[model samples]
Target: MTRVFITDDHTMVRRGLRTLLEELSGFTFVGEAGDGATLLAQLHHQQVDLLLLDISMPRLDGYSALVSIKKEWPELKVCVLTMHEEPYFIRKMLQVGADGYLIKNCPREEIVKALETLAEGKQYYPAEVSQLIMQDLVNGTPKVPLTRREKEVLKLLVMEKTTAEIAEDLNLSTHTVDSHRKNMLQKLECKTTVGLIIYALEHGLG
Candidate 1:
């Protein structure tokens, strides 16, 4: 049986999760809680194989729970269950090693599929989260930290604008534009124009 754990602040949400998982075979609802701390206690007192985690709760949000859980149970699989549908949040969760990411608004069937996939030791990214992953790839400008002007410059790079074009648009010198371009490429780890273009497209950068 797949031992499942449900964590959310809403009373109705916990019930709904229980019902949804109970309806599926080979899956069992081992425990549930209204916050991360309570959920952590439940897991320690009992046993759970998979966790349905919500990003927003009264105490210890999903991200924090993820970090804590991995520290205690590194192999535990966590599927983020939240209303947040933004690409940045999705990327953050995945980057932190979340087993799966799904928007709470998804159809119940997709939720089932996510669980079943996770049970088989595979990651399942709901449509919304997948789009965010693409954006992460696209907007991977760099970790070296960019000044506001440099960011503006990289945005132009995604548009395939040359240094001259960017300089004209931003009212900057060609040398300044070139400097920003080099920084963007180095920070984002992009070697060519096409690489940056693909990165922008993935990250939903304009």
Candidate 2:
């Protein structure tokens, strides 16, 4: 039997998923949690085959939680179900060791299928997730390994905004924006703002 646990901030979401999962045979609903911290605590005493987790939550976000869970239970299966459809977050979650990604609005059947596939030691991402991944690959944008903040800076800089403008928008000091600009220039191998912008455009980071 597949032991599945649901970790989401919404009680209704957990209840609905639990009900649907229980209707499916060969899978057992092991537990439910409102946040990653509680999920972590539960895993200390329970054995689970799959974890259906949300992206945004207190204590620990889904990506970070997946990293921690995988370190503790290296074989753990985690399927990230989130409302955020941004490719950046999706890529980061997968890179950080999530087994699968699904938008929160995904169909119930697809959610079930993703959990089952992951539990069986296979991998699956919802259609929307796969499409974004393919687009990133085809455009060669996903290879740029930058922190979230770095990517944000790249986006703003590509729009011809100065470091001070980006600083104000991101609520950071001008010095910090300058530092990020330098880091971006070094990482992107661009000597000028125009060069950096062009590089970002070419790589689809903008």
Candidate 3:
């Protein structure tokens, strides 16, 4: 079971999340806090696997809290559960190490799915959030420029294609595809395929 903690300013929101977790089979609502400071304090005593955090809060905001959390507990999975859908907020949270991003108004099923995805050691950004990131990327520039072939490989990667499949589609050898993947990983400074996917999606390369 995934041990979950919630940090949101609203009492109703916390209660609602707790209720949801109680009804879910694979999740355990371990604890909650009204603000980031209290949440940080409680984390030291809790064995939490996942954190559902809100962006706007009293005392310490989510952004600062996220940075601190990641610095101290880099293995802990954090999902931003907020009403903020702006590109800036989404990008900021992802850059600061959010494992998932979900709007507060999203359906309950989506929340459960996001949690499950994180539990499986994968990142989750809802379709809307991804669209916003893509739009922002279109208006900006990539941090590290990618070659044309690299962009093609990345686009296929974002489509969830395997390396062999990508090679088949691009009429390249699997060895060549692997080489491209490695080069992209090095150039983008991504440690894993998922990180490469996130970076490519955020930079419009995908």
Candidate 4:
């Protein structure tokens, strides 16, 4: 069974999720928390395979919590459960290493599927989230074109490859990989690697 924990500010939301997980076949609702700090603290002593995290909360927000989670527990699977459908939020979560993303209003079946997908060590983003990403790309296409090599690097970046891994895969020096990343940022008018990834996803480069 997939050991699961929930972190949300709303009691009703947590209760509802708990009930759902209890009824599900492949999941075990290990615990729940009202905020990120408590969740992190519990994680230290609990055995959790998946985390259903809310983006907005008191004290420690989801973004901050997620960064800490990824840094401290790299193997933990996090599926962001939020009401926000904005591209910025989704991109930020993706950049922060969320394993999956789900809107609060999404059907329960989708949530089940997302959790199952994460349990199987895969990423999940429903069609609505994907549409939003594509729409963002349509609205914000950069004028400058990328070289073939740049496109290859961008693709690997989207796949969450590190600089060294990318270099090894492409048979290039880490310096060359970094240079390509910098070039892509400048060409795409993006300030960060996450921006490049978002752009690449929007443009179907991923």
TM-score per candidate, chains pooled? 0.66, 0.69, 0.66, 0.65
> Model 1: which ten-residue window has the lowest total lDDT?
139-148
- Expressed as tens digits, the lDDT of each residue in 1-206 for candidate 3 is 99999999999999999999999888999999999999999999999999999989999889889999999999999999999886657777887899999999999999989988999889899998778678767877335667889889889999999989999999999999999999887566577989989987787776
Candidate 1 residue 114 C-alpha distance from true site, Å:
0.3
Steric clashes per prediction:
8, 0, 0, 0
Highest lDDT model number: 4
Q: 109-191 in candidate 2: lDDT tens per residue? A: 89878877887899888777788778877986545567789889889998889878999999999998888888777555467
Q: Give Cα distance to truth, residue 12, candidate 3, Å.
A: 0.6
Cα lDDT of all candidates, in order?
Answer: 0.82, 0.84, 0.90, 0.91
TM-score of 3: 0.66
Error of 2 at 88 (Å): 0.9
Question: What's the TM for model 4?
Answer: 0.65
Q: What's the candidate order when arranged by decreasing lDDT?
A: 4, 3, 2, 1
lDDT of 4 by residue, 96-196 (tens): 79989999999999998998899999989898777766876788632467899999999999999999999999999999999999988755658899999
Model 3 lDDT at residue 117: 93
lDDT of model number 2: 0.84
Count of clashing pairs, candidate 1: 8
Q: How accurate is candidate 4 locally (lDDT)?
A: 0.91
